[model samples]
Target: MQATNQSASAKPLSIRINRVLYGAFVLLSLYFFLNGSYQDAASNLGLALIFDPFNQMVRWENRPRWQRAWLLVHLLVMAGIGLVYWKTFSA
Candidate 1:
């Protein structure tokens, strides 16, 4: 009975909520970026990374192909955006 209760209260629902929150952060980031709010966009991007919607905690070699690609692309995009913003505004 205790095991059943713990299992019933476990992560499935929280995982779903995290995914939703992650998506919202990404969308909000995009919105800020497009609207010329670089600081807010970058902030949201950091928040999204904290949420780690893609669950990239697994070892690099242990992660499947799509997971690796997702995390890599995310980091690359963030870097690219930061570079562009810095170059454009930090003269």
Candidate 2:
């Protein structure tokens, strides 16, 4: 138990806060999307991106193909969601 506590406390405060916010934003985005609020989902997703959830800390050229693909797919999906929201509500 003491080891676990020490490990938990080892992380910097900002990183902990970021992890919590990242989770919250991702869940919020999902909630909004499921309830037919595409605009809200897209906006929340954009906010989540600011937290860099994909974590490209590794050098881009050295990263595995799947990592690159996942990030690319995520960005594409975000763009798709924004386009959908725009089309649905635009005048």
Candidate 3:
């Protein structure tokens, strides 16, 4: 019984930890972007996507259609920035 209670409590704690890590990744991506580290920014964004493709923190799926479209546009812009940086610097 004690073990069952402990396991049940652990589930929410694990989810919270995952959300916190996801938030950190998003913040780090922004930091990299601001500092002109496009490659790293893109990498962090990729990690975030892997962790939370639907953008749960932002409740992206619950938002209206236009907002969802804007989120896609934002991701594309980030990808473009990284691509341009790679092309310019990878000679």
Candidate 4:
């Protein structure tokens, strides 16, 4: 009974710790994104480009394979930016 009460009491503290850790990770990633030098941007951009669909057309296509691939690439880029943005505002 006492052990259960003690364990339950510790849950909030554990949650708080997790929150702090996540916040720190976000801030660090943002710092890398924003304060990162031109070389950093170039590297990340190059990495992003690798996933781009070279055969994709901007207009309508018979199949969505290229479109879907392009969308996935953009989504990843946006996610990266969002992480940085979230950190920029969180601070």
Error of 4 at 36 (Å): 2.1
- Count the clashes in each prediction: 0, 0, 0, 0
CA lDDT of 77 in candidate 3?
A: 61
Q: Write the per-residue lDDT of candidate 4 for residues 1-91, one digit (tens) a residue.
A: 9999998888667666655654554445455668866335533543444333333334545657866675565567666766777899999
- What local distance difference test score does each model get? 0.78, 0.75, 0.73, 0.57
TM-score of the candidate numbered 2? 0.57
lDDT of 4: 0.57
Q: Rank the candidates by TM-score, best first.
A: 1, 2, 3, 4
TM-score of each model, paired residue for residue: 0.62, 0.57, 0.53, 0.41
lDDT of 3 by residue, 1-91 (tens): 9999998888777677777877888899999999999778877866764444343445756777985874575578667767887999998
> Model 2, range 1-91, lDDT digits (tens) per residue?
9999886676555576777887898899999999999778877876776665444446878888987785676577678877887888995
Candidate 1 minimal-lDDT segment of 10 residues: 49-58
Predicted structure with the largest TM-score when compared to the true one: 1
- Candidate 1 runs further than 4 Å off: 4-9, 55-59, 73-91
- Tens-place lDDT digits, model 1, residues 1-91: 9999887677666677788988999899999999999778877876776566654446789888987787676687678777878999999
